[model samples]
Target: MVNANKVETEDEYIHVRFRDPDQFDEIRTPEWAEDPAHSVSEGSEVRMGQEEGSDDWQVESVLIKKNVGEDKAKDQAEEIVEKIES
Candidate 1:
């Protein structure tokens, strides 16, 4: 199962560990959050998708490791939907 981490500071960027034992890929904050659409708030869930001028990788499917804090996941999910619509 995917684990949600508590983002304390810059040291706390999302660390995605592939569940597949054979797969080994790490996506950091600045690197993973490459597209302008990919943002990280204190409490919000951001999905991966292309906006306009973004490259091919822009519109890929990325499920961010969520947070354990209170209502953070729900808030983030809502924010992401808003962003996508806008």
Candidate 2:
């Protein structure tokens, strides 16, 4: 889940909910994601991964679908979360 309000602050960062099978974690928007034109909203589904031997996960892309509804975006996020947890 993304915290909608947090993105509006001066920091221009959003809070993302992350799960690691047995636990839930929180991640903030990275510097690469600070561009207003490409910034992700509360329901956006983003792809994230870390480089080999690196501990930090970086946002790779934000998935966008034409005419998709907010509910659908949320569903997508949930599905990704489920896969990660599984």
Candidate 3:
């Protein structure tokens, strides 16, 4: 609920911490929002929030075309990470 944006990543994801992580315990990750299969992705859903403790959230998963090249994929992933850190 804080911010939203597009990002690419194979495994790296952005996590948001909350003042009360325990309150979000009842929440659950959607079927489509499950973790990635360790594949490349771009413009994938940049999710935020955790299901339980720390009220944290993370990049649900990234999606990229199968034929996409490595450089572009890597750049996209890096951009997502940079946005998270910055």
Candidate 4:
């Protein structure tokens, strides 16, 4: 099961945890949002990083997009976590 997290900052984002952080490459970029076709707003982005004081890894997707909705961001993040953990 994937647990969603509340973003602690002004940036609108969706967060999730992974059991194994080392199995994949961590990506942080806004390029996905740059094309205006990725369904994300101009400033939207995604990244993977270590969660402080925890064995689980975290992936955050900045979701305030002009396209469909923020649901895409959470869905994408959840997909990644599930893929990597499997």
| Winning candidate number (lDDT) | 4
Any runs in candidate 2 off by more than 4 Å, and if so which?
A: 1-45, 49-62
Q: Write model 1 residue lDDT over 1-86, tens digit each, in one string.
A: 22333322223333222223222233123343434324644432233433345342221222333443335543443344344444
TM-score of each: 0.29, 0.31, 0.35, 0.35
Residue-level lDDT tens digits of model 4 in 1-86: 55555432233443333334454445444343334413333344445545555555445443433343446655554554454445
lDDT of each: 0.34, 0.38, 0.40, 0.44
Candidate 3 clashes: the total is 7
10 residues in a row with least lDDT, candidate 2: 2-11
lDDT score, candidate 3: 0.40
lDDT of 2 by residue, 2-27 (tens): 32111111123222333231221333
Better of 3 and 4 by lDDT: 4
Candidate 3 C-alpha lDDT tens digits along 1-86: 22223333344443322223343444443445323322324333333446644655554333444345444544544454445535
lDDT value, candidate 1, whole model = 0.34
What is the C-alpha local distance difference test score of candidate 2? Answer: 0.38
Rank the candidate models, highest TM-score first: 3, 4, 2, 1
